[model samples]
Target: MPLFKRRDGGSIRDRFEFRDVLGTGAFSKVFLAECKAEPGHLVAVKCIDKKALKGKEESLENEIKVLRKLRHQNIVQLYDTYDEKGYVYLVMELVTGGELFDRIVAKGSYTEKDASHLIRQVLHAVSFMHDNGVVHRDLKPENLLYFNHEEDSKIMISDFGLSKTEDSGVMATACGTPGYVAPEVLQQKPYGKAVDIWSIGVIAYILLCGYPPFYDENDANLFAQIIKGEYEFDAPYWNEISDSAKDFISHLMCCDPDQRFTCEQALAHPWISGNTAYTKDIHGSVASHLKKSLAKRNWKKAYNAAAAIRQLQLLRISSSRAVTGNSSSNGTPPNRPFPV
Candidate 1:
């Protein structure tokens, strides 16, 4: 159940007429619903099965808390939540414009300037989150959704399942998608909001080149590359990308969180704030690479980077217990790394 219950004694079904299913997951289903008071107005309602969420109740509650606190143009809005006997319902903004990469790939004339504008919007939203003490632990292409199906649709960051509030204290949990996750996160070190900046850097790199910065068939190798902050602007693809654009990414993707660009710094970069980002059409190259990379789609399926992180976390726990000679009471890793 959510920390706070706004709806006193009514069901979500009382206000919205549930329609077709938009999508489904292991323990939840998203349905398109129409507001009863306002005809034709639609919203997506996520119905989560309480029984299936046996061990993940806190995760659901955290997502609700974070989403409730966030109010930004680029971030998905949470309208209302309901707790039922068998399920929990979340009413959210209906974003029909699909994924960010899908829109980019479908565009005919994508450019560095266009990518810069997109990143600027994202930075603005993230800056607001940071200011509000919220950190979107996961920021990947899949989590970014278009507000509408218009040609000039704005991007909205969705899915706060892994998000955390500053009040949660120093976050050391190795979370977030593998390719976009920061080095500190992979190293199991205490981290802060700068991790989100690293993810934006990875997204910016992919936006310019249509592929991830660090990738390998082997999960360990990929984590090692990210841990070392090893990536390059390859020839041909990046030959035409502006120097300012590369500089922007380098600052955000820096190995050291302290050295990495903050959201404000990134927003003020020439690439985003100035006109240094080139207008040259990079769609052909970027789209071609995007199709070829299959990118994190494959990685998300075939490899479990989170599992590797969990293994590392487990190793650390074992080492600490050995040094302190305090056996774990439950015989299980504590605070198991949040699902990535």
Candidate 2:
């Protein structure tokens, strides 16, 4: 049985006609729907089968809860929801603009100043989320979207499947994409809103350059590197990036969550305030690397989502078994030195 009651209503289809499929994932299908009363306005309705969400109802419900109350210019808006016998549907704002990376690549000229502006907007949204006691556990390029196909549309943060609200305080779920995840999360430590800041730092590093700060084919190796907070700005790609830009990333990538910058602090940083002249167009170089990066999508990404869920389960089981907090307690030592 669903945790929440369906708001009294007629056939959902009578009021909202599904037009076309927007996207599909393992748990849900997002469709472009037309409103009967406001036919001119179209909304994206995410349909999730109750059977498919048998074990994951908590996450889905938390996502709906967060989306229902949280509203920001850079965050996708949830219009309404319906709890039918077979499935639940969440109606959201329809955004036509493409992914953030694609939009940057399409631009003729992109620069650090441009990157700062983008990060600033993301920070504002994240700041608002934190203020409202919500943490977006999964913050990545794929989750960032533009409002429209317009050249200057604002990026909206989408996909809250892994989000955690204040009610679930000091989350230890260990759920999120591998690369952009905070080190504390990788270590399975009790974490708070700072995880979102770490993710923003990763996004900032990518926005300025075009590739992730941490990249590896070996999952263990990648996790170890993240644990150590080891990363470098390689030649050719990062040669032109400013030190201030790197400094900004450094502030957030600290291994200790206590040392990382909060969204408010990040927003007030000099880089976002235009202290450095990062206006020189890095689009030519960045777009080239970005194209290759996006096309050669990491195989681990598909596996990581499942792995995160498994990791979560393992953690729960371990807690029941009273396993030590140290990652090494599981026998696979997480402290193994990362290959340089």
lDDT of 1 by residue, 183-287 (tens): 888777889999999999999999998877776544555566677776777766689999999999999999899999999999889999998999999999888
Tens digits of lDDT, candidate 2, 91-157: 8999999899989988989989889989999999999999999998889998999999887889899
The Cα error of candidate 1 at residue 153, in Å, is: 0.9
Backbone clashes in model 2, listed as residue pairs: none
Error of 1 at 213 (Å): 0.7
How many clashing pairs in candidate 1?
0
User: Which is the leading candidate under lDDT?
Assistant: 1
Candidate 1's error at 221, in angstroms? 1.0
List ranges where model 2 is wrong by over 4 Å: 1-8, 298-300, 305-340
Models 1 onward score TM values of 0.89, 0.88
The stretch of ten residues in a row with the least summed lDDT in candidate 1 is 330-339
What lDDT score goes with residue 79 in model 2? 85
lDDT of 2 at 130: 92
RMSD (CA, Å), candidate 2 to true, equals: 5.5
TM-score result, candidate 1:
0.89
